[model samples]
Target: MKRKISTLLTFLILSLLIIPSSLAHDDQAKHDADLMCVFWGDDKVSLSSEEKIAFKIIANAAAITIDQYSLNPNGRIKEGTFNEIQEGLKYFGLPELSINFNDIDLNIKVSNDGKNISPNTHRLYTHLGWNYKKHPNNDFWKKRKHVLIDSVNRLLFNSKKIFSWFPWASDVVYPPSEQCDAFCAIIYYVHIIGDHIAGDTADKLKNIEPLIHYTSMDTPGIIVELKEQLQIVFQEQKNSYTFFELDQKLSDLTISIEKNCDILGFIDTAEKCKKNQEHAEQLLQILSKHLPTLLKNESFFKSRFK
Candidate 1:
């Protein structure tokens, strides 16, 4: 009887020790999966070697644009910077974007003096970040999220479709207008290249749902708040914000969510909530750092191809 009781006690202790560790590992795996969904979406798109190089070049250009805007939000972009992007695209045989003067839907218009043209404020705001549109239904946020996923899908595959608007206008002048600033130029450049940089992977891409569906299955309100904040800041402020400002707003929202995670009682514990918050912040950091880092190491990226 004594031996049996001792063995039973040992078994109970071992179970207690092993079960938590196993749970922790499972939690970590879930966090990682959630982060992947936020960044890459549900479908996995693979890039070829040549396509990787093209993606890098375009990403670098975006990084350069972000860096410039962060430094001087109101300054004019350098002609050389624009030329470098154009040359990089040409080297990769990607389609160059020309202004579609016939497209009445384009947000560009003649200046007050009628001697110059430029993208309007609304265009600049929408291109640089998210924009809010009022809808009568509750699916507005979901639709907006779908738009983001679709843009990423186009970036990864079906890039040619992005440039199909003016496939034959190769010799057309870039900048479309001399009055283009950093905001106008970079937005135009990204819109053109984001579609085609993924090269021949077009057919393999798939549509994905919002990050909320994947990351915050238990508490989707948090993700909705995040999306709402992003749209409100850009839509209401016009063209008066910078990347750093936006980052702070997002960081604050994350922190608030972290604090309320336990009080909300949706997760198993405060520790799990904290871990999820950390993963979300990490995703934000990756986005904020990716472009600037690529631009800073532009030389290294270029040497890799050579």
Candidate 2:
């Protein structure tokens, strides 16, 4: 009996040790999957200041919508605002302005009903304690990536249609349609393509600095930097299709934008398009109005040109 008891105790001790090891292994696998999903699939939309304001309303509406859906099937929790808004903004490619997490309130109205909030819109909200370092196979991540692609693709497709017919769209105020579309389309195309490409790279790198270092630069500078990097990527890949043309177009537009500024100029004619382009156009106009005068009047251009 004494020997049997000792054996049982030994077995119990070994079992306890194995259990935690198994759990840790499982958690490591899960973390890997999550990181893979973010790396290969997540492509956030970059927003200008005006766009951020507009999209905040959209994000809030989305949160409410998701909450309402959860109220039906899943019960609601008191919306503990965590890095959620910033995460969303970061995911959406907004500049992470110095807005403290404590200040931004994401109040989730929980109805007395028994349904829980759905986690489809953003996995980050659902998995709080998820580890992001370990990657085993990418199966779990692939599914998550598909979910995100479907969601963002729909929004982007719809955005293109709505923004094309905005009220502000006019021939005289904005550039011509071909020109405007070229600009708008390039932004959208780059967003989708670049995010898809860069996101995966960022995920593997476990940092966004390689893809988009928001702190080191502002919007225009970032755009220029990204353009140069992308040129190198395409060149390295020896891609002869859309890659070369897209890179050139973006480069040309960036340069054109830098060269001429017109305050009266606008980028969008429709209300449905994203506001960032409009704001960009507005900035260009301001520069155009001020830069020429500053240069010509002050003999700045003469001195430089001479």
Index of the highest-lDDT prediction: 1
- Which stretches of model 1 miss by more than 4 angstroms? 1-49, 64-67, 70-75, 78-81, 99-129, 132-222, 225-258, 261-280, 284-306
Give the residue spans of candidate 2 off by over 4 A.
Answer: 1-217, 232-235, 238-241, 262-306
Error of model 2, residue 259, in angstroms: 3.4
* lDDT agreement of model 2 with the native: 0.29
lDDT (CA) per prediction: 0.31, 0.29
lDDT of 1 by residue, 275-297 (tens): 44454445444334333322222
RMSD of 1: 24.0
Report the Cα RMSD per candidate.
24.0, 23.9
The global Cα lDDT (0 to 1) of model 1 is 0.31
State the weakest 10-residue window (summed lDDT) of model 1: 202-211
